[model samples]
Each structure stands twice: as structure tokens, then as C-alpha cells.
Target: MLRPVTRYADDLSYVHHTGFADLARGAARFVVDLIGPERRRVVDLGCGSGIVLRALTDAGHEAIGVDLSPAMLALAKRTAPRARLLQGSLYRVPLPSTDLILAIGEPLNYLEPDARPPALAAFFRKVARALPRGGRFLFDVIVDAPGRPLSRRAWAAGEDWAVLVDTTEDAARTRLTRDVTSFVRRGRRWRRTRELHHVRVLRTVDLRRLLRDAGFAVRVRTSYGEHPLAERRRAFLCTKR
Candidate 1:
């Protein structure tokens, strides 16, 4: 159940491979610390470029990476040659029995508002069936802030490529729209690509409720590491009860 990638997928993968390795490394470390030396099989949902999977494998765990974008999967294959990689949609991807399932990098944000609950429920059911009683699921979500001002951001990769992102929220603030434009150097010429993305925002209470209904005992942290205040991005650690 794979879907076609957005126009920005190629440039996004390129940027991730070139500059985002440290972010992935930090996430991997956080995950490792949280789970300890269990030596359990790990599955990384929406595993772009297999950075986390690579780290897990290096730490002596059997790791598998799953993603929908072919461009991302290609980079993952190159970056983590020894790790197993699969390309498919999260909703229908068949995964092996695992001790930990990771859905990082804003994968859930991509679902529409109405589809979020059902999709999460289905995902939880699948994980419940695939994992043992003490298995764990770790994920992060972006908290919604109503009336947030629109903003535009940009990033560059030396002289080869650049990406511009314009973000705006819906009137009700339940959905966020991002218009992205990428400029890439192609030999003597430059190529421009544009893509529009719509993401839904979820409340912490609703997310906790959904996980509870799906048979998990959930704990949330404002940040992955120690922090004094809650941040927009929150992480959820769920264990099968």
C-alpha cells in the first residue's frame, strides 16, 4: 500500500543524507538509553535513510527499516547497507515480531485529522499482535498551537541545493499547510521543484486516550531528554500491559 512520493521527496532525502545525520544519531542514542541493552528486534516505521536503524544495528540489535518513499529507501540502502529495508505504507506494511517499534520523524503528522484515530488504532492492534507482553512502542508527535502566526523558513546545502518552506495554519488551526520549493543545481543549470503538504495536529489528551484504548500503558515526556518546560514536540513511551 505505497503511495507516490511528493515532489520534494528527492531533495528532502538529499538534505537528510547530507546534513541530518547528527539529529538521527541523537534520536538513536535516546532510544537506546530508554530501552537499555535488551537485544530485542527493532522496527523503525517511516525510517528515512535508516539512520536510527544503522545505530541500532551497530549496537548489536536486529533492526529493520520501513518507509514509503523510494528515494528515501534508496538512501537508506546506501547508508545502512547491512540493515533490512522495506518500502510500504505504514497502514499496511507487514512487520516481523519485534520488541520495539519506532515511528519517528513526524510520520503521524502526515495523516489527515479524521484518519488519525483509526490509523493509530490499526497500527496499535498490529503491534500488539506482533509484540510480546512487555514490548514497547515509542513515537513522537507535534502539539497543535492555535492562532500561531504563519512563517517561512529556508535551508541550503552548500551551492548545490536549497529549500524554502512556507507554513500556514487553517482557520481552526487543526491543519497546517506547508508549501515547499527546492532549487537544485543540475550540472550547468538549476532545477526547481514545488510541493504542497497538509498535516494534522493532535492534542496530547486525545493521543493518550487513543493509546489507552489500544491496550497500552502510556507515559509522555515533554522532551526526549531532561528539560524544565514542555516543548511543542512530545514523546510517548507505551508498553503493552
Candidate 2:
């Protein structure tokens, strides 16, 4: 079993094209619209590098970020010194009272099936205890489709890198497994990395049901509106009742 590798800011500059700005905008709009006057305190769940949290704070909203990757958090501190960053997993968030909560960039898609209920329950419990009535809990994930090709073969074009990855789905076990191998050439040194990610694939209906059970009502489901690049994932916006 392989675990996901953590990427630092320097690494992110080379890997992610938009970096964090694209994610920040989407989350900011959702939180501002949902929390209205109460959007003072925003929690960025799975806040890799605190990009969204930083954006929210710059816009005058207080922000807190939680992530499992310490390497990423280190970079986040340099960029968003005003926001509080905590080292923690999405399944367990430590906070009290938030105007809005966000888990963007397909973090929730990484949970396994049996683990999802508990994770979602934990998220809901934390948000419920921290947020007042009518607060918002928003998240997004890549809709799972079995036997789908994620990319082509591994290849490098100049300094840019690309690879093909896929996830294995076990219907009987309700389990989804992700595997990847990527390599980047730095000067004369060739750096290669591989990771194994195990996630759960909840049906659309089942996901909604879990949210409802967690004390939220469906607000909207928006297809990512970014430059055709985000067409690969689905975004779900839910609100606490």
C-alpha cells in the first residue's frame, strides 16, 4: 500500500498550472454568497497550501486552514500569515464556530467507502458544533467512473510533466483505489515518484443522502466553470440548516 506524496510550494509551481488562485475564487464566491453577513469565519477543510483560506482573509473574512500535509502548510504560512493553519486530516477537524466551511479540490473523493460515513459524520459534527444555524458546509469531488482513463503514458515536455493514471473500483467492496507514477527531470537528475490513493465512490444519490443525514440541505450542484480544464470534476454546494 502506497501513500500520497506531499508537494511543497516550489513543487506546486512546477506541477499545478493555475496553482491556487483558481481554487480560491470558486470557494470565495460560494462562502460569501452562503454566509452573507456571517461570513466572518471560514474554515478551509483539506486546505492544501491555504490558498482559498488566504483569499478569504484578503477579502476581509477571517480564515482557518486544516491539512494533513505539513510540507504544504509550511508554504501556506509564508503566503497567508494572518490565517491560522492546523495539521489535521479532513476526517477530523478541530475548531469551534465557523461562518462557512469548504473542502474543495476533490479532497473528499479520497475517502474510502466505509470511511466516508464516519468522515462525513465527523465533518458534520465539527461544523455543526462550530457553526451557528444556517452556516454552510461546501465540498466537491471528482465523480467516479470506472474503467476511465485519467491520462495517457508518462511523458515530459520541456519542464512540464504529464502522466496517465486510473482508479480501480470494487463494487462488492465499495472501494476505489488510485495509483500513479510521475517523473520530472531537474538538470541532470531525474526525479520519479509514485503514490497509491484509496478512495470511496459514493453514488450521487447516496452522497446527497449522507449530507442530509448530517444535517444539511442541498443548495446547488454546479459544474466547474473554469476554462474547460475543470470539466473533469463535479462541484457540490451544500448548506447547513
Candidate 3:
């Protein structure tokens, strides 16, 4: 069975942080720019392995990273040692009082979105509650779009590890499921691991409306600053009124 929304495990987290951190790295500049020169408390929701957190701290922000994965947070410790890190769901964790909240890599799309309003209205409201007037939220989500194919397969490799992902969209269910397999060099041999992840395919219109109702002024974008996002995905730059 495909896994429901949950914290990433050891192998996948390792592979992702090591081999596929570029997107987060690129988004970091855009994130840092948005915060300006003033010191602000920034909370990274689902911070993964802290590529962005590193950038945030390096730019002089008070940074806090929250993730449900111990493995990922462990990596964050090395990447941004000066930042405070916590382990918990973005939806359940106590968001540190912050001027910015970031959920990059479309973390909210993996919420196992059941029957509540899109954008997970309650969670958006919680974020709104945590922010003061003019607080910012930078995040992205995979959405049903004009040219998204029904299935996709890709692979990435580093000097010591490699990963393959096969993904399929279930339009009827409004979700996408990914089967991830990884190989890590342990000695003379490579160890293999596999897992599945599911993400809901969000509707952009619904997301915008929900965010607006949650008290955010939302701007939809197809890129992070000048760094282009993958097709069928969108970033939401939201500000609390």
C-alpha cells in the first residue's frame, strides 16, 4: 500500500537531502530577500534537511526549523547548527512566533487531505493565528494543471547513493502516489531501500480562495524569485493582514 502522509524515513531523507537539495537551495535566496535586512524570526515548516535554514541563519535571521522526521532534523543540525530545530508535524507543532513561515517542496500537499476545505483551512487559520500583522508565508504546492502528465519516473544519483521515483496521479482521488527506491553504498556493496509517498493534487483556485478566507493576501507564482518551479506546481506568497 502507498504510505499516507508521514515523516520521511532514513533512506529517503538521506537521499533527498544529499542528492536533491538544489531546489531548496535556490529558493533560499528568494526567501532571504523577502525577509529584508531586518532580523526576523523565521519558521521553516517541514524544513527537510535545512538547506534553506542554513541560508536563513547565514543571512542573520533568527531561524527555527520544524519537521516530523528525526532523520531529516538530524541533517538540519549539521547544515544550520545555529538555528533552533524541532520535530513535529507542521499542522500539530506549536509554530514559534514568527515573521515568516516557509513550507517549501510542497509539504502541505502531502497532508492526506481528507474532506476538509482545500488548503487545509484549519491549518492555514492556525498559521494566520501565529503571525502578526504583515507576517509572510512562503510555500509551494503541486496542483492539477493544464499539462501535467498522468505518470512520471525519474532517477538521481550521487557518488555514493542513488534514488528512483515512479509517480502516478489519481485524478479521481485527487492524489499522487510516489514509489521511491534508493541504494546507498555501505561498504563494498550497496544497500537498497524502498518506500511510498502520497500527495494530494490541489486545485489552485480552491487554494487561493481558502487562503484569502484564512486572512492572507495571496500571490500565486510559478517561480521562487527568478528560479523556476517545476511545471504543474505553484508557490503561494501570502501575507497576513
Candidate 4:
């Protein structure tokens, strides 16, 4: 079930401030701790709205963000005016050599199952070519939770906006389909937007193997913070070998 990669267009607006600021800030702090306060250049792959980029710049580090959504990039530019923002995909983007590379927010999961390995290999090769030895890469993936039923969730922000998400898992529970619908207040009217996202869930062992084959020394943790299992997201810290 290989589907063409879909870009987030109108859906970007719905997620710009989707209540994940705390998590983004936490991830940023963890990154700073790992890299120290040397003010190194950092590139955030799939950096939606520049949340982490803002944190990086505020910490006195040079930061750049790359994302596939122009709408998201626009918001990012406005939010993190100090950081450079680019519109592009993770697979092929012109990026400078950096001290650290971030691909958080389950970016890799967006790829289809068959595309994950080759795409990840190319991603690692690009990072390797764009970084010096010992450079670090940090990313996260959503691990499959078997026996979890189809989940429906909703969010509302006063009278300004509302979102509904319905998630359906494949029989094998290795793939997820997310159907999102958003309603935003505009003047006296409410506008609606809808998007469908497909994602693949990868086990920790699979992720470690990918990183190892890509020439990295990898470490996996349940969370980036001091807590071991605060969230379902698993973080991968890799150093170029």
C-alpha cells in the first residue's frame, strides 16, 4: 500500500498551535543539553512552525528549519524571525553542514512502509555528507501499540477553532490512517478543512538497525527528558561514525 507522499497544505494552519508547545520546548531543552551551550548551527528537519527553532535561537544557537508545507513555513517565519526557514521535503533539500540535525514529530512515520528503508538511508547519507564526524542526529518515531482500538479525538480552542481526528489502524497494526477535520472561525463565519495522513509504525529494533546501517552509533530512550516513559514517543540519538 504505497501511496504518493501528500503535502500538508491547508491543514498546516490547523496544526500551527495545536497545543504541543510544551513538548516542543522540552525537546529543544534536551537537544541543548546534548549539544551543550557552544552556540552551534542546527537544522530542524520537518520543523513545523519553528517551535524548536525558536528555542534554539533563544538559546543563542544558529538555527534553520525545513518543512514541506509552505503554509507551515509561513507561520514558522513569523514565529521565529531570527531563524532561516525553508520549504522542502526531508528526502532532498539543500542544507548546510550542521552540528546537529533534528527530525522530530514523527516525521519518518509519514513515509510508506516500503519507502522507509531507502528513504531513511538516503536521509542518513545526506546528513553524513552535510555534517562533520561526530555530528549528532536526533529523531523520534511512534511505536505501534497493538490491540489499541480505532481512536477518535477532538480539540477546541474557545470559539476560534476546533479539530476532529479519527484514527484507524491496519489489521496488522503496522499502519495508521488519520482523518482530520478542522473548523476555524473567520469573521462571522466558520471555514472547514480536511486532510488524510498515512503513517507507518516502526519498532525500536527496526529503527536501531536503520541507524546502524547508516553509519551511526545509536541510543534509544523512551523520552528525551529525565523521565523514562513520560510519552509514547521513542527518541533516537545518533552520532555519525
> How much is 90 displaced in model 1, in angstroms?
0.7
Against the hidden true structure, what lDDT does model 2 obtain? 0.62
For each candidate in turn, the TM-score is 0.86, 0.75, 0.94, 0.87
Better of 1 and 2 by TM-score: 1
Candidate 4 lDDT for residue 90:
76
Candidate 2 off by > 4 Å:
1-14, 17-25, 29-39, 112-118, 144-164, 170-174, 185-188, 224-232
Q: Model 1, which residues run further than 4 Å from truth?
A: 1-8, 112-118, 145-159, 226-231
Backbone clash count, each prediction separately = 0, 2, 0, 0
Cα lDDT tens digits, model 2, 96-205, are 67777788776776653233334565566666667777777777765543445344333333454543346555655355565655555677876766655666554566
For model 2, what is the error of residue 53's alpha carbon versus the real structure, in angstroms, after optimal superposition? 1.6
lDDT of 4: 0.75
Q: Give the alpha carbon lDDT tens digit for every residue of 111-216 in model 1.
A: 5323343366677778777778888998877666433444446555656877777777666656667776777777899888776766776778878887888888
- Candidate 3: list runs displaced more than 4 Å: 1-5, 112-119
lDDT of each: 0.74, 0.62, 0.86, 0.75
- Best-to-worst lDDT order: 3, 4, 1, 2
lDDT of 4 by residue, 1-241 (tens): 3343445665435454554455577788788788787889999998887888988998899999998878778878888999998877777788798999998777778863233433666677788778788999998877754445445465545447777777776777577777767777778988887777778777777777877888889988777786343334688889999
Q: Of the candidates shown, which would achieve the greatest TM-score relative to the real structure?
A: 3
Error of 2 at 14 (Å): 6.0
Worst 10 residues of 2 by lDDT: 223-232
Off by over 4 Å in 4: 1-5, 11-14, 112-118, 145-159, 226-232
